[model samples]
Target: MISVQGLTKTYGGFRAVDDVSFVAAPGRVTGFLGPNGAGKSTTMRMMTGLTVPTSGRATIGGHAYRDIPNPGRHVGVLLDASAQHAGRTGREVLALGAGVLDLPRSRVDEMLETVSLTRQEARRRVKDYSLGMRQRLGIAHALLGDPEVLVLDEPANGLDPAGIHWMRTLLTDYARRGGTVLLSSHLLHEVEVIADDLVVIGQGRIVAQGTKTELLQSTGTVVRAVDDAALERALAEAGISSVASPDGARRTEAEARQVGEAAAHHGVVLLELRAADGAGLEELFLTLTSQTQREGAAA
Candidate 1:
């Protein structure tokens, strides 16, 4: 299992990560999420020992990352696919990782095949590879050790829809076989589709963490009217509290039925209304992190 307790990182006077604590359990995929500058990446960096933590601890199977013997065999990390040596062939990249971890060279071929990299493509220099191909190569390098835990940051960033689906399947299969996975992504739709658990951070602190089902159940509904003020007034009259979304949509804990009835009673015209689940991952993400969002004036 992957564990982080009271993890914090500071730069100058800025607190990049603050008291972050969560666990990515064995046999489960934990989706780590946040908007830009929410500190999700900082926390992941700390967990992998890429950056020093100002305080607290991060561990894999009860041992600090630096203390683990043959650390690559214990945890696989893919923080940046593009960080690979552009001069090296995809095969060479994985071969080097295998060598570092003291794995047989056969493991490189195995991983290349596992990530769907054909022999011809693996022989090409990484500088010629597309972002998608680089991602595949990076994934192969991470898995070269056949580690029990995976920490990937935006692994699907450059993948097409089909590639993303393939990645989801691969990680899910890994977890099914008892591997731990912590996946960080801005793509909430993909995360929602595959994550067993979720950890949401904003402004250097964890805002929410729980099983996917639990988080979705707590997400409320969003409703919007041609006249937003009218909708708000109607909801107010019905004793339902709501806050306007950035786009003028209003979100509330009230169910759709209740909101509709209130609109009818107040003679208001609703432009849109949907449960949080029906609205999909975007609505839930916006609602949860709305307070921390950094908005700019109209262009």
Candidate 2:
């Protein structure tokens, strides 16, 4: 298991990561999510000991990452797919990693096959590899040691739909075999499909963290009426607070029965009323991190 407790990092007056705490349990895949500049990468760096934290701690199996012997054999990490040496071939890259971990050279061939990199491609220099191919090579190196824990950042950044499907299957199977996986990605739909738990960060702090079901469960009721202004007024008069959704519907924490009764008492005609349970991960993510997103910056 990976435990991050009050992990924080600051640069001068700026707090890159602030009081972040979450656990990636064994036999589960935890999806780390945040908008641009919300400190997702910073938190991951702290967890892997790539950056020093101003306070708190991150540990794997009750030991700090740097303190673990032959860490690659226990914790697989792929923070940057493109950070490999440009002068080396894909096969050479994995070979060096295997040597560092004291793994057998044959492990390199097995990992190349595991990630579906053709032998011909492996013979080419990493500088000639496309972004998608680099991603595959990086994954291969991360898995070469058959570690119990995996921490990957944006592993699907350059994959096609089929490649994305393959990655999803691979990670899910790893977790099924009792390996811990902590994945960070901008692909919300894919995360929704495979992640068992979610940790959402905004402004360098954790905004939400829980099992997928608990986080995605309906938080309120959604209702629409012929007269939106009148419905709003009715709800206000009934002491129920609501927010208008993009579809001209109002979502409130009040139950459906309460909303319907309020509309009826106000002599308002209701067009639709239901539990607001259909919001998917994209909607929830946007809603949770809307304020943290930069105005005109690319994520």
Candidate 3:
């Protein structure tokens, strides 16, 4: 439902986003992730038309955001989730939001309750609301028009554990019902739980884009066994390469779960079977980006 092509944004000499391209499919939540100052937010802003790109193009359903009628109704956006009128009550703010979207007043209350902002709190000024409350309020505002596509930046930032779970569940449900969700987050575990697809950025460029399973599969894993010598011999016969630990420790992250099962069937003693850090999506992200940065610096 969303496509970004060669979307590049530059701030003088620094490129915030560079030649990034990806697609957010309907009926799925796509994780937009990157390290600190990797231009994740900049990319989101450009996609939502809050900030124009220096070059290249992004579109929703084949049209530029500005060309969409009632873009708010076509896309729900919660950029900060904390920016709100300090003096306005949650209800008033959402009500005003409804007006802007030409939605009914009931939508205001519906979304307020949807985000679990109690009637009492809804009546209180936004200035009195906690960070989480403000975030929910921002979410309520975003949902006021019941848009089909959602672009969220750190939606779970300040939410409590339960709140974060709720947010994840809600996003999942939305996608299940055919909503397109493009969420940018720094929380890898959180994204791992919710995202079916991922688009990773580093130094303003997209380094990886695919389903979670696809990205995870891209980097092979090692599984370690307690009987290092025996396991290494077995793996060598099986055509798998493994290194011996300095202490004669035998370990492998060679695809974890399934490999463990296979090894067990082969009578490989179970010592420790878990994913090695260097072979997962997280490791791939760090290794790829850091290498790129080092190369850029050396040049």
Candidate 4:
């Protein structure tokens, strides 16, 4: 439902987003990950046609957002700040946006409900909104036209844990219904749970993109084991092997569960198993981003 090719965005001499490209397919949630200042918001803006890329293109269903007829109905976007007339009620604000695209007013009411803002709450002036309420209003605006593709940047920024959980389920459910969801957030663990795929970037360039398992596999190793000696023997017979460490602390968190599952099937009492890559994702992200930053500096 979405495609980007060689997307490049620069401000002055510094590229905020460089050569970044990926796709958000229908029926899947694609998590866009990067550290702070990695140009994630810039990339989202470019995708929504809010900001023009200095080079390359971002398209929705094969058409550039700018050229797409009735873009409001084709793409839904919630960036960092949502602009609404404070004096206007939330319902009025969403209705105004939907009206511009000639969408039915019922869609506006439906969105308000979908985002869980009741009719009375939706009637309250936006200026009275809390941060979480404002966020929901922004989401309501995006869903005003029932767009096929949704792009949200740091959507969980001001949300409480409950709100964040709600957002996760909502986005996942949207994708499950064949809509395309592209979300950018710093919540790696949350992404790891709901995202079917990930696109990781640093210093404005995509360094990785794939299913979380695929990306995890590249940055680390996957250890599999069976609890039985026979299963261990089977793995050996199948040519699967793991490195032995004196302390047996090698299994990285990424592969620990898989390793445990493997060990259980084999009936082998696994004393230890771990990813050979040997580090938590927090460390992995730091190493990866720092290395990219160093490369950018040297270049």
Best by TM-score: 2
| Tens digit per residue, CA lDDT, model 1, 48-95 | 888999999999999999999999998999999899999999999888
What residue runs in model 4 are displaced by over 4 Å at the alpha carbon?
218-284, 292-299
**Once all C-alphas are superposed, what RMSD does model 1 give against the true structure?**
4.5
Worst 10 residues of 3 by lDDT: 290-299
The TM-scores, one per candidate, come to 0.85, 0.86, 0.78, 0.76
For residues 216-294, what per-residue lDDT tens digits would candidate 3 score against the true structure?
7534444556776667667666655454444444344356765666677679876666555434555545544553444
lDDT for model 3 comes to: 0.79
RMSD each, Å: 4.5, 4.3, 8.1, 9.7
Global lDDT of model 2: 0.91
| C-alpha lDDT of all candidate models, in order | 0.88, 0.91, 0.79, 0.75
lDDT for 122 in candidate 4 is 88
For model 2, the superposed segments whose C-alpha errors exceed 4 Å read 221-246, 250-275, 295-299
RMSD of 3: 8.1
Worst 10 residues of 1 by lDDT: 290-299
Model 4 lowest lDDT segment of ten? 244-253
Per-residue error at 224 for model 3, in Å?
12
Model 4 C-alpha lDDT versus the unseen true structure: 0.75
